[model samples]
Target: MSWTKVVAITGCDSGLGWAIAARAAREGLVTIAGMYNGSDTEAARALKNLCAHPYKLDVTDSKSVTEFQNYVKNVLQENPKYKLYAVVNNAGVMTVGNYEWQTPQMIENMINVNLLGAMRVVSSFLPELRKNGAINDFKPRIINVASHCGLQALPCFGPYSASKAGLLAWTRALHLEHFRDGLSVISFIPGGFIGSSNLTMNQVENGNKMLSHLTEEQKSIYEKRIRTLNKYLGQASNNTRYDSLSNEVIIETFVKALIDNKPKQVYKVEPWRYKFYYNLLKMPFPDIMYYWIIKKFLAFPDSE
Candidate 1:
């Protein structure tokens, strides 16, 4: 704790990112918070007074990510003991609807933010990890903020789940690929939280905008279901941050993923009932059959 350790965390505008950045700063680590918005946002204001230094970073942009890498390098050069200890890829986006109902633009937007965005950040900051491993034989880490949906049947949250699944796979690959380099990569699969989660009216508003993209025929077929799904997801996403109270306790799994010397490849913290489903996904049942059964029973009938 006495040594200089820098932790860069993306998506600090809200939800898990803000909580983690705030918590890291409290723990005395140099926390760099990556935010997509300009300095006027509440996240910028709240994190400004703490250990977190909000940096403008659009993980999807090469120029932005390059700038972030330069920033980390400059920070490390200020002191020989300073190391870029970790980069928490926490920025993500979610769209709610049937997969077939999603427009090409919607699909691209989701992936660009959720999957490629994480990839861009990791690729950009990897060089700074070099100095970290040389210090006290310590390994720099990459903690990817994934979801339990990557582990099971997340239903209407398909696109978002797909992105997380890729993240899970990518994390595992990095863990293996960089083992000899003393770089630790892990995935944190969150179940739910005790405060207001990320999904909210903002996505509902975005979903409404996408509705305009549908053809008249398509709208007649999928409009009702899409609206219903978005409303349900808005409630579900916000509720995931907390079971009853609004607090930063939900960021514990993230902290564990970062500080543990030998972190689990996938650190999970969810509800009691998720265990059964988690096991269910791993059973010998064929994926096709399992999905079919899930759609037939667990999901409501699609609108004609």
Candidate 2:
């Protein structure tokens, strides 16, 4: 078992995944970029141009996970020197809506992709990691690209929040459960991103479709809040120019997660307000104070 530094990053076809892979490649770590959309995206083309190896991976499918694992294993065997240094579970789907209005499929898809899909990939690649891999590199890491929704739930983003909350717990458990095995699971909490960059449009479209099934009476009860939430989402989607957002912050965070001697248990890419909210939520305050302020700005009204 030889030790070589290599990192596997999933969801590399777009968003921060692509950026992370590109950064990893530039930093001289043998990078494996995983993409679900085979040969069809502009992001795919960009990823292929980097110092990385692109592979087809569908984390939602066990067969696809196994095949990707086998392929990587073969490549490592052929080299006889390189080993997987880190596994990053970055592929996730989001669904935002009133909890009651969310269809079963919507709820299931969110949980399955964001939670179980990552579990499949991590479990599938464990043996390779254990075989003189990142443990030898001195900092073995299993990272989950979680979200702020996990820590702080908004009103209408129930499904997405639920999924991420589960991921947060899952990461915490893995961090403790696999420590003796020399595995460190880091939870990355990215702020709400909406636009051509991340996955907001798909989530919005699917949420609307699912809500269409609601009866007129059911819709009436939540329609005002739904529209308000949509308005809020539109505003958020337009705020891509957030002061704190940058290639450097995201890429560096990724590098630290994979290569830093001591990585933070929770790497949050949010501004000071989020930190404030997190702290505020822990306080035993009345509804007229911090909680009320949050609902006014961060959340849409929800029907009881």
Candidate 3:
């Protein structure tokens, strides 16, 4: 009795989503990848000849989500003999702004696509997962893609960090709920910025556009905040680089988590760390307190 796993993933338009779907298909899983940009996205085009199926889905839209859910249900139902193993909640967006500087729409977009989207996908797909539990080989699982920023308080990247924090909390709570029901939940947290991914440049670009629409006083405040963020993100860029191993390595972890006889509750790795810098963040002390105090000094001591 051979085993075949069918999988569904979101955010296949690029980055980790593209890498995960491509690797899963390469490893012989039936992979259905959801992309907001439909099949014509560059990420979809690159993987079009690959074994994965790129379906159009905007996680923020209830109608589109419902349609994709139906598509997955039909595919799984019509092939009842196969096991539906994993769904990777990988779709998300990032926004950079001081709380006072951010617009209502920007806040809503970040919260919707990053936090709400994950829950929406999980809620939509659970019935199909629950249906597979009776089969001997069936082991349904959910993997939420979170970030190290979720664990730490990043200075300038507030919305992204908050979203990941929400995801981490959600993953932890949901794991408890589904553990006894024959389902597995894992949170995959990747540390540091990886190359070959969208660098939140869209948010920066949008901020610049919005600057023209603001009143003179509002524009002045936004410009200063934007400069602060631009400098920080630029500095971080010099430290992070992604090699093929970063993508392959993370995907390999995903594959192992999917099939492991005893999968881990959480997977955390920094593909480019020369030392345990992330560990240093966990250091109890005035070490972190002093660092933040100095960072605040550099950022805006006058405001204090």
- Best model per TM-score: 2
User: How big is the positional error of residue 51 in model 3, measured in Å on the Cα after superposition?
Assistant: 1.7
Candidate rank order under lDDT: 1, 2, 3
10 residues in a row with least lDDT, candidate 1: 239-248
Question: Per-residue alpha-carbon lDDT of model 1 for 1-304, expressed as tens digits?
Answer: 3468889888777777777888889888898888888446777877888846788888888899888878777877887777789999988877666676776877787788888999999888876675466666566888898887676646667888888888888889988988677788888877654135564436677678668877899888878877776666566556343112234445676777878877778888766566655666677899796776556534444543
What are the per-residue Cα lDDT tens digits for candidate 3 across 184-262?
Answer: 7889976544445655546556566556556789876567666656555444334232222245666777778767766
239: Cα error in model 3, Å: 18
RMSD of each: 3.6, 3.4, 4.2
Candidate 3 CA-lDDT value: 0.73
Q: Candidate 2 — what's its lDDT?
A: 0.74
lDDT of each: 0.75, 0.74, 0.73
Higher-TM-score candidate of 2 and 3: 2
Candidate 2 residue-wise lDDT, 194-229, digit = tens: 553556646556557655878899877876666666
Per-prediction backbone clash count: 8, 0, 0
Question: Clashing residue pairs, candidate 3?
Answer: none
